[model samples]
Target chain A: MRGTMLYAPFDIRFQELPDPVILEPTDAIIRTVATCVCGSDLWSYRGITPFTEPHPMGHEYVGVVEEIGADVTGIQPGQFVIGSFATSDNTCPNCRNGAQSRCIHGNFMSTCQATSIRIPLADGTLVPTPDQPSPGLIPSLLTLSDVMGTGWYAAVAAQVVRGGTAVVVGDGAVGLCGVLAARELGASRIIAMSRHEARQKLALEFGATDIVSERGDDGVEAVRELTKGIGADSVLECVGTAESMKQAVRCTRAGGSLGYVGVPHGVELNGEQLFRALIGVRGGPAPVRRFLPDLITRVLEGRINPGKVFDMTLPLDQVAEAYAAMDQRRAIKVLLQP
Target chain B: MRGTMLYAPFDIRFQELPDPVILEPTDAIIRTVATCVCGSDLWSYRGITPFTEPHPMGHEYVGVVEEIGADVTGIQPGQFVIGSFATSDNTCPNCRNGAQSRCIHGNFMSTCQATSIRIPLADGTLVPTPDQPSPGLIPSLLTLSDVMGTGWYAAVAAQVVRGGTAVVVGDGAVGLCGVLAARELGASRIIAMSRHEARQKLALEFGATDIVSERGDDGVEAVRELTKGIGADSVLECVGTAESMKQAVRCTRAGGSLGYVGVPHGVELNGEQLFRALIGVRGGPAPVRRFLPDLITRVLEGRINPGKVFDMTLPLDQVAEAYAAMDQRRAIKVLLQP
Candidate 1:
């Protein structure tokens, strides 16, 4: 099988890799249906998140089970399923509490940007579609594995509820999906802070009632203005930069909640000012598995098509072009069909 | 009536301030039976929090209602009561949602520390005690007005529960009380991170199962070791410093909650890193009024005496000494009597 591997900065390549197998009774092998490049992958791609030898390079995927371990209880071969960017034993205390991403034995999925892959704790990590999803819904279903699920968790963590105001910072795929999730969670007002016209339109389509085409201080002011000078009732910080985080806090009301799902870069949380500001801050690596099932349903029901975030698509062999599109900001998320 | 006034960093004076009267239709006048300096007050005295011209400083008090406005409905004159540090109308959405400290028209009562003080929104702010409280319970009951209530809120915000482990990251009255609060909340293991013998002893007496004398990184390690390499299920951050906040975040389990009530000092929140960290953070100024009624009952019934935090007592005239002792770290909290 061939998979994407990165040996160093700007060194991504698709090369032959050993085929995967069921290493344990709880492991299962899946033939990749669709995979996508994530914004987080770019960090390591740029060599900021350092590494060693070439390693498997993807974490998001939707596919049909090619083989199932004997211990796998709920899933079988040929069943379409959406698995999270990370694997979790859903029975753990943390997993049971809706924090599957932080489960005691949580494992990052072996990069799924390959023809074939092995998933551990298959019964706990994979959620099968009630029925085989049609090929047209493949891309949308694949998104529920990571970006879409993450956006949903951001909305939930921020506690955005019916009739409340929700603000999302960052124009990435996660942010756009957050706009949809906030609306689905019943937020009466959804504000998307973005600059790209295409992204803005998508945000609006996904339920953003307002848009702030500014960043940093100006962005905070713009959000406050839209919120009647009180700031947003909930803020989803989807960009990991320090500036974006600061903007997230500044744009939230005194007692509002800030749900953050960004892969932080150069961010520093100072305790004193944050405590005085009085906003509750939550969110870590999202429990994507927690939302995958419901998100898949939403995709199947045609309530949303989050895969529209992938403006460009390519064959698995065109992985390099996919990376370039996302890196250059020409695309939000680039999908690959294996 | 005489009251203690903070004139400068080190200058506190006893002055014959004007007698307080019911200034608003919802206000009442109370004759204080007991009053004490708050942990926040010492911040100014220690030159950490800025000093303003003649800041009338006390915020914690328990007393008998001397008079009530015609419209005051829930409370009446002659009632023994304890109120929150910040008075709330308790009718706004914020208050209705249990965040009384952020009430729409809330007022901090630190400015009215005199023997006779006017309580705003008296019907909503004050909590009734029995007609008579045992003399021995006065100190503890007085604590319910702020310190104990604040501590309890911290514990509650941290989500402490039965069969769980908790860590308190401050040694002030609030943090010490958090140890008591954690126990009362049914936390199975209570860890008080304190180096001071006085506070440490009090923590143990208040049900702390262990004490970590270290701070920051070392302290986090100790807590992890105690919790079998995982961390406390909850962490109560009661100190406003950056270091303490970091410890609160560091000592919590991956999915555990950190409830904080520390007045933030220069702290900044990094959304990205925090998103990857083990804990979830929530909390702000304690809604003491919301918890005071129940705490006052416990105090009156001899269930707790959190006022042991006031190690020294002084006449109103010794206001300078009272501030000096607490500011210099010689006392936990100072009791000022008229």
Candidate 2:
């Protein structure tokens, strides 16, 4: 199987790798139908997140089960399935509490950029489609594996209330999807903060009622002005930078909630500042597995088209191009057909 | 008028001061019926919080309105009233969102330890009892002004679900009140963290079902052990130190909520740590005014006795002694009869 590997910063390569096999009784092997590069993956690709050696890339996928371990239940060979970045038992205390991403027995699905990948805890991680999804629905289903689920988690974490205003801080794919999530959650006003024309257009298409083109304090001021000087009722932070985090908090009204799903890179919160700001703060690795069922339903019902976030698609061997497109912002998100 | 003045660290003095008068049309003057020294006040008295010149002390008070400015409405002179440490207009966006403590036109009340104190935003800050309260009910009513209100805010911010377990970090008056608030909010189990026997007794009486005396790492371990390694569902962080904050966050299960109402000192959060912890964090200065009406009703009905936290009482002129007792931990709280 050909897989994507990052040996060093800006060094994405497509190389032949051993095909995956069910290694554990609860594991299942899936032949990838679709996978994608993520904003977080760029952290390492851009040399920001450190790595000592090359490793398989990609954590999002929608595929068909090719083989199943003897102990695997509910999932069967030939079934089209969607699974989150991490496999969770879904029965642990944390999982039961809706934090399946932090499941004690979970492991990140790091080899999904390959033709075949093995997923552990298959019974808890894989959600099969009602039928074999058409290729047109594949990208949206793939997003349920991570990014779309993550955006939904951000909206949920922010406690987006009906008729309330919600602000999304980042203009990346996740942020655009957040606009969709906030809209689906019943926010009457969705404000997307984006500087790029293409991304801004996508944001609006995803249900953003307003856009703030400024950055830093000016950006916060813009959000405040838009919210009539009180700040948005719910702020979604889809960027992981310190400045983005600060602006997200500043753009939230006192007693409002902020859901930050971006993997923090350089973010730091001053205790006094956060305390005085008086906004609820929550977000982390999204429990994507938990939302898979609902998101699949939404996609199947044609209620949402989250896959619109993928602006570019490439064959598995063109993995480097996919990474480059995302890194250079040429694509909001890039899909790979394996 | 006479007042307690903090001349310097450990140098409290009884001094004659000009009587307070309405300086704003929205102000109202009140003669102190009961005032208390707060745990936060000790920060300045101990030189932890800076102050170069002598200043009037005390922010919690229950008093009788002596006079009202022309603009003051709804509250009449001679009414028994409870007011929080801060006065808010309660009409601003923040106040409308239930964060009255951060109201746009808010100001902290600092002359409450004196015989007479002027409260700004009288209509929004003061909540009057049905009638003149008997002397026995005054102390409990006084707690509504700050400590008890703050505790209630902590419980609310933590989102204590009925029948869930709540862990209160810190055993001070506010923490003890947190136990009571959790119980009132329908928490089936309340764990009070304290090393002091007397405070522990108060905690138990206030509805704590268990007490964990361990501090720091051991404390977090104890909580996890108690919860079968999952940690508490709701954790009230009543202490604001970095260690306490970290322990509070650690003792909370993934996806749990942590309400921290402490006046933070030297606390900072590594963004990655908080992002990974997956706990909802919310709290700041308690919006006491928001809870005033309900709390007053509870106190008047004799459903709770939060004033038991005030173990000692002194005449207004003995303010120095009152500060000393609380500063030295000789009293959980001290009431001043002005």
TM-score of model 1 relative to the true fold? Answer: 0.87
| Alpha-carbon lDDT of model 1 | 0.85
What's the C-alpha lDDT at position B118 in model 2? 91
User: Model 1: per-residue lDDT, tens digit, B270-308?
Assistant: 445467753678877888877876887777677888878
Worst 10 residues of 2 chain B by lDDT: B268-277
Report the lDDT of model 1 for residue A307: 83
The fnat score for candidate 1 comes to 0.63
Candidate closest to the true structure, highest lDDT: 2
i-RMS for every candidate (Å) is: 3.0, 1.1
Cα lDDT of model 1 by residue, A106-216, tens digit: 888757999998999899999998888888898888888889998998898787999999999998999999999999999999999999999999999999999999988
Q: Per-residue lDDT for A1-338 in model 2, tens only? A: 88999999999999999988778999999998989899999999999989999999999988899999999889999999999898999889889989898899997888888888899999999999989998899988988898899999999999998999999999888898899999999999999999999999999998999999998989988888899999999999999888899889899998899999999987887778778868888989999988989999999999999999999999989999999999988898999997
Query: How far in Å is the alpha carbon of B332 misplaced in model 1?
Result: 3.9
TM-score of chain A of 2: 0.99
